[model samples]
Target chain A: MNSMKGKPMNHKKFEQMILTPEALTSEEREELARHIATCESCRKLSLQWQKASRMLNKPLPMAAPAPGFSARFAHSIEKRKEAEQQKQVRRFITILLVSLLSAALIFAVTYYSTNSLETIIKDTANASAQMLFLWESLKAIISTVTGFLPTVLLIPFLLTAASAMLTLTLLWLVSIWKLTLQKETVL
Target chain B: MEHELQQWLDEAMQGKEESFCRLVDHYQNGVYNLCYRMLGNRHEAEDAAQESFWRAYRNLHRYDPSRSFQTWLLSIASHYCIDQQRKRRMTLIAIDEPFEETFGSNSPTPEHVYSNNEQSSQMEELINTLKPTDRAALVLRYWHQMSEKEIADTLSLSVSAVKSRLFRARKELAEKMETRREEYELHERETYEPQKI
Candidate 1:
């Protein structure tokens, strides 16, 4: 309130304006000015605030980030990208190994089944009837071993490799999930 | 584009690389200055500034665009800095040692020390000694010239809280300055009073 007008401004609010720098609205500025003219304490604080403004406004030198900061930051980002690629590469290798192991296991199964005694005896009888049958049997076995077995071997091997890979991928995903689930990180 | 910045910032909250880098560059100096003034150590300031931005980036969605961007961001940095100070003070107390001092039992008193250039530095050092929250209220209000409302918004405090702090800080600074002035007068009287008599 304007004292001369037989009213009063809120002393608390005027003091707040002194504490808060930056321009108050024109109406606020006028009110504060009128209040300060009548209020010695507010007037003194206003002067102190002016000095504070001048000191701070002189513009102290603020240091920038390191000269190569952006570049170094980019470098770190690249480093992280490389680490991720390396992790992916490790995963791919693990899958490859599992696939090869599964292939070996399937090969073991085929070897036992086709090389059974019953099957060999039947083949021998057939060979007795045909003079060239033994040669044909050996050729058939060689072809099956070389051509069909490896492919058959690959089927289970690929599945094993793929399944293991999927499991590992899920584990990696789970760790990241746990990381995100964490509360109260520094950032 | 400004709104897009806001949108990008929102997306960035989800950990968008592009927005993080962009926002970092956009406000690095402002953020760095706030941290530097808050911490009073270059290295710590750098770390604080970096971490504050990362935190803001991590929690960008929580930012209210209805508020000024800089004020909102400064608020985050202020909290980060305050937390650091609390941790530092706790750690310092835990270790149990006084900060280095030029005054010793044989050394000149604060009155004598006031005559030297060290006085200004000492005053600055003393200012830095204030709790981070108090120092922040002082720095942002005096140094950055933020409005009380802006500061309140920045710190997530009510406007009255900001005003109360500012008032207390002023009274505190004045009291310290007043005490130092008295000490200097006492020293002058001791050194010259006998001769005058």
Candidate 2:
């Protein structure tokens, strides 16, 4: 070992080197060794660290879980799957009930607005025709605007919009799929 | 064994309960040991191991087959234990509790058993003083024999972070050990000096 005769020792640097032995070069390690030989506190720290490292690294027998661990895990998975199916059934029933109540409420409001069932049917048909007419009118306006735009700009614009819509739809589907997976796992 | 494990993994991914249970049986010791070391208690370790398996089962589809299955399983256990440790920060559990229940019945003598338990408890106490991620890093390094890169991947940290954590953890453990030794020596001196007088 090289003696630390002429040089002033930085205990902090040596301590850090001692802590991270793997990070040290061979020369640095030798320097640390020499420092430890002379410095009492550093020597004590080094000894304690070696003891601690040995305790940490000692290979104790692996601790096994209690017997029937696999069986218990299987049972829990079964219980979870059954509970998930029940939850899905409950959610479906709730959605069905809500839809039915909404339909009933709409029927009551429509019947109250139009005294006769025949008038209600006629009014509904008229509203459908009016919506179709408005959709056609909007299409006509879009076609007129498209005609006014240059083809170069129009093609790129349409492509961008289509791609954007497709990307948004994909993102929405992926999020829903992820949420379903997460819910199942959590359950 | 690798081929058999792969076969079981494939079937488990197909949702075969028996295959998954087989996989569980093969890895339960490793998973449980990691949990026990990380959580510093058998009960919590057992629960954490079960939870980790459950998670791995649910996320089987997400598991990349190219990686080592043991590493993936241990990664799950380590993360779960880290979260448990974080939640348990407010509650102080006794880390120095003797693990007599975990000791095998084949020990040679009571003295040997006592020595082992004392050493193991002292080590556990030193390990338990670390922060959760650092503890995970140290456990993976020492107990699981995981490389720094593997520990980084397991803990979702960079290799440098894992290195720093390991270094810091070792320093802290050394300091704690030194303090405990000083206290022990002081106590012995006090008791011995008074008796002599």
Candidate 3:
């Protein structure tokens, strides 16, 4: 237990010492041998440490990497390199296209912003109106599809409502998606 | 610095398949052995080792050359094992089959070698029951035979902390072994004793 409290030994040197297969220097080894002639506990601990140093002697089974692991690993690395190259090329192309598109967008918006705000609003309003009249559009669709029975007309209105809801939802989702894609302007 | 290694890394980074393959050729076994010791199985160890190398290749540019390359690579594999153990929430893996202790007899064969294996299995089972940290301490100290200072660096603990952890681990293992020995003794006594007539 005192070993627990004691500061770490010259453990850095111990690794080196083990590699040399001699526990101590010539003089130190002679002294240790002399001591071990009489000192029982030190002798035993020394033997134990010496035995532990023979770690590789026990010869833990380490198989060579399975046959053809090298070839397969090489193939996998090639695939990885190919994939990485593709990714880089795609990235460069994307960056190039994006820069071009961004330059075009910047030019268009800068030039057109003053005049286009009104036009943009008008376009949005038209889009929203189409959204707002979804029920009417769906009703037209339903009537076109199921046009015979008066009774069918009543049930057909329910179908129209569902269709209208789905269409509006989809339109709303698409608008959100498009908005996210657009770069934000501080102003 | 091996100029060859540098060339390989440079070419691989430039997306040369041949150079990258050469890199894999160089380090596969070392990675596999480290993983095998930490993971203690073939299939799982192979996967972790393979993943470690791939991760190393993927992040090759980020590698700092100031440190030992093998050490850096091992650090990656070490973290992978830690994350894996955390995910599984177990110190030892659960093989689909019952405990299969593969290896040869220490003593002469057919001299009830199964008994010796049972003893080793019992010890391993007790070790598995220990806290993961404690088990790591025991394994590094006794199994891998790393010095306390070496373990401190490997596990990123202070030397004193490594000592304390190892002491506790040995104490726990000893206690468990004692209990098992007592149980074995009692079982043997019951089985061998003739009923008083």
DockQ: which candidate is best?
2
User: Candidate 3: lDDT over CA atoms?
Assistant: 0.60
Report how far off residue A88 is in candidate 3 (Å): 9.9
On residues B1-197, what C-alpha lDDT tens digit does candidate 3 reach at each position?
A: 48998888779778676787677777776666556555556777678877787888788788776755666676677668767767878765543333333344454464545664455445556666666566665555654556777667666679888777765555455445556667878987887786542
Give the per-residue lDDT digits (tens) of candidate 2, residues B1-197. 98999999999989898999999999998899999988878788889999999999989999998888889999999989988888877333576555634556775587977666667777777787789899889888887889999999898899999988988888888989978767757877988998888
Query: Which stretches of model 1 miss by more than 4 angstroms?
Result: A1-54, A72-187, B1-15, B90-123, B178-197
Model 1 clashing residue pairs (backbone): A1-A8, A1-A9, A99-A161, A103-A157
- Extract clashing residue pairs from model 3: none
Residue A118 CA displacement from its true place in model 3, Å: 10
Candidate 3 residue-wise lDDT, A1-187, digit = tens:
1122355334323323323333367876665565555545444445544533333234333334565666776657667767876686677557655755665466446435544476567656776887668768767876776665576356445545555555556556556435534533322
Highest TM-score against the true fold, candidate = 2
In candidate 3, position A107 carries an lDDT of 43
True contacts kept of each: 0.18, 0.71, 0.14
Candidate 3 or 2, higher TM-score: 2
Interface RMSD of 2: 2.0
Cα deviation at A109, candidate 1, in Å, is 44
Instruction: Tell how far residue A185 is off in model 2, in angstroms.
Output: 52
**Could you tell me how far off, in angstroms, the CA of residue B67 lies in candidate 2 after the best superposition?**
1.1
Better of 1 and 2 by DockQ: 2
